[model samples]
Target: MSKSNRNLFFSLYWLFFLVGISTVLVGQVLPILARRFSISDSESGYFFIAHFAGSLSGIFLYNYQAQKSNFIRTILLGICASATGILLLNADSQVICTIGFFLNGICAGANIPAVNMLVAKLSSLRVSSSLQVLNFFWGVGAISSQPFFHALSSDGSVLLPTVLLAGAYLIAFVFIYSHRLEEKTEESSRVNRASFWTVWRNPIAWITALFNFAHVGLESGIGGWLTTYSERFAKEGLISATPVFFVFFVLGRAIAPAIIDFFDDNSFIFLSLLVLLVGLVVIVFSSSYVGLICGAGICGIGTSAIFPANMARFAKIFYPDASKHATPIFVMGSFGGAITTYSIGYLSDYFNSLKVGIFVLFANTLILIALQMLVLLGLQFPKKDKT
Candidate 1:
């Protein structure tokens, strides 16, 4: 990469880190807020939906305004919104906090696709490596949040950490805006007329979307509720279980990049799904907390590479003109994560068992595995012989 491109890539990487930290902070704080507000577990999940709704709105808004302007501007706007959201979270008013979180989610949703597109443009030849590096920083950010939140803890209020997250987003905004790339009209118009549904109509896109849906559903469902599962299995309170969950999740995400280089993307995904299956079974049947923790770690390891691997695979499979297609795939995947994470909470309420809700994640994993197999089989079949 040229010096300019290298700088751009690293800058975006830091932005990814900031976003990751923000996400983890939100995840950690939501449950605390739930307890404070005296809401049910399922109700707590609505906070995630509120966040997703914001993100969905941001996507559409960006799609409209971004065509006539530069994406960097959109990213900066997102950062500002996210920062405001984080700060609002510290307010005493519950209504303000909810609105803040909604804005934060929207900002985050818009920022991610714009950043990913920037990275794609910068490192056209090594998209996978670039994305993996970005994701690695994201893991680092999540890891940092655990200790940061721990240090910020005080007399029953999560305000300090929320302030810290707001500061982080502000820093991200500065970096992104300062290094903003000049927009090229050629690239901007490349897919200006293409609708999201237009991209979704491709057979490969649908297959990948479904695979992403299951992949994200399984991953987010587990991550969102893993602490609750830990509380049940370890008999600890929410705060105590979270650090363990964060450690496991961070370790798995951190290791994914190195591991991907060694295995074919499809093979890596297939193996990960299989590992997830075993881990889920272990969690289901395990007799003690230790067993459950072990299972959770295994599941994390299994899921660690799914996002990056599938993302890279999708870029390759749909390449030569992937930007139009890849953006929607990512959007759909994000939507899937939101849906699955929220669904798990609702299902947990219905079943009255966090364990059962988690087991349902295993079934989603099975569906992912099946879809991937079909893709693999399709690849294996010989091309039709023309007379």
Candidate 2:
């Protein structure tokens, strides 16, 4: 709405946007990492584990000290952490790569929630619209990561992608560092801060957190396995498959703002889940490249709205506590990604079938739907919250 708001938007956008690269890019390139390091799919879980550890720490620590620090100061610190991690990714040693992923996750752990808090706090007409815009930028960033890496891998070089990623963070650092915003007034600060205990006690908070666990895990699981799926079963590279699904995912997010007012939250959830389930079903059944890519697009479209739309609602429901609640949501979320990614790899290896690995996503989506049903029924949930 003002000069400061524009700057915050740019800063927040890149903060989420850049990490989109890691979210999907790492999955697409996992095969390379495994071969280069002589690790198994199960061993690959270590990267996810390292990242999860970092992210879990980030969410908890930020919640503990959020009130004591301003958004800019905390975000800059995260950017530095993330940049260092990204740089470490270039090393040849297996241990170094694992460390790099762990540190890179640490950056996400700190930066993602902090940026989310900043965006939610924007003095806007509707926080829902603001959040949709946030997720849209995230979608765009996610799209960039897949195709960009594929192109580099085609040339048998990841050097440019690494440099580009470093440059993205550097630009973000400079812009975010230089920009200043109006300070929060004392009264607003008191209203905005919520202690962890208060947030943890809310059942809706836990359900919502669990929902994020399923949703993020499903997305990450799909990304981690899709390339392998394409290579082993179909005839294609990771790049071809990722963009098809991600483009639809981007479309879904871009259109989310327009549809929010059109459907009630419950109705929207049903519609999205239905589409998502259909996509996953197609993926499991498809034997051809065309079928797999099509299924990916459907899955992307299905996933597009879940995270952003649900996040917008969380801000509405939790408000002052949203910042605090974000911790558990993401903590469980990291668990979801970590466990699901690791499980799929382990299970796939156990079964000697990539198809078996994908069933994990199928089971996960079903669980997410059941959780949302609980939310809609108002089971163990308060009808109204005091902010």
67-171 per-residue lDDT for model 2 (tens digits): 644666667777777777777766787788777777777777777777777787773347666777788887888887767776766433566787788788889
Which candidate should be chosen as best, given lDDT against the real structure? 2
Instruction: Assess the local accuracy of residue 336 in candidate 2 as a C-alpha lDDT between 0 and 100.
Output: 90
TM-score of each: 0.87, 0.91
- What alpha-carbon RMSD in Å does predicted model 2 have with respect to the real structure? 3.1
Root-mean-square deviation per candidate:
4.2, 3.1
In order of listing, the candidates' clash counts read: 2, 0
Model 1 C-alpha lDDT versus the unseen true structure: 0.69
Show where candidate 1 strays beyond 4 Å. Answer: 65-69, 185-201, 237-259, 380-387
| Cα lDDT tens digits for candidate 1, 1-387 | 577666666677878888777665556676567667877768877777777778777776566545554567777888888888888877777788889878887776777666765665565676666666777676667657656765786755777887777887777777666666555544456465564445566677777777876776675566567755676666653344345544665676677665666767777778878887888887789987777767777776677667776766666655544544454554566687678777777888998877666666867877898988987777542221111
Clashing pairs in 1: 54-106, 55-106
Error of 2 at 277 (Å): 0.5
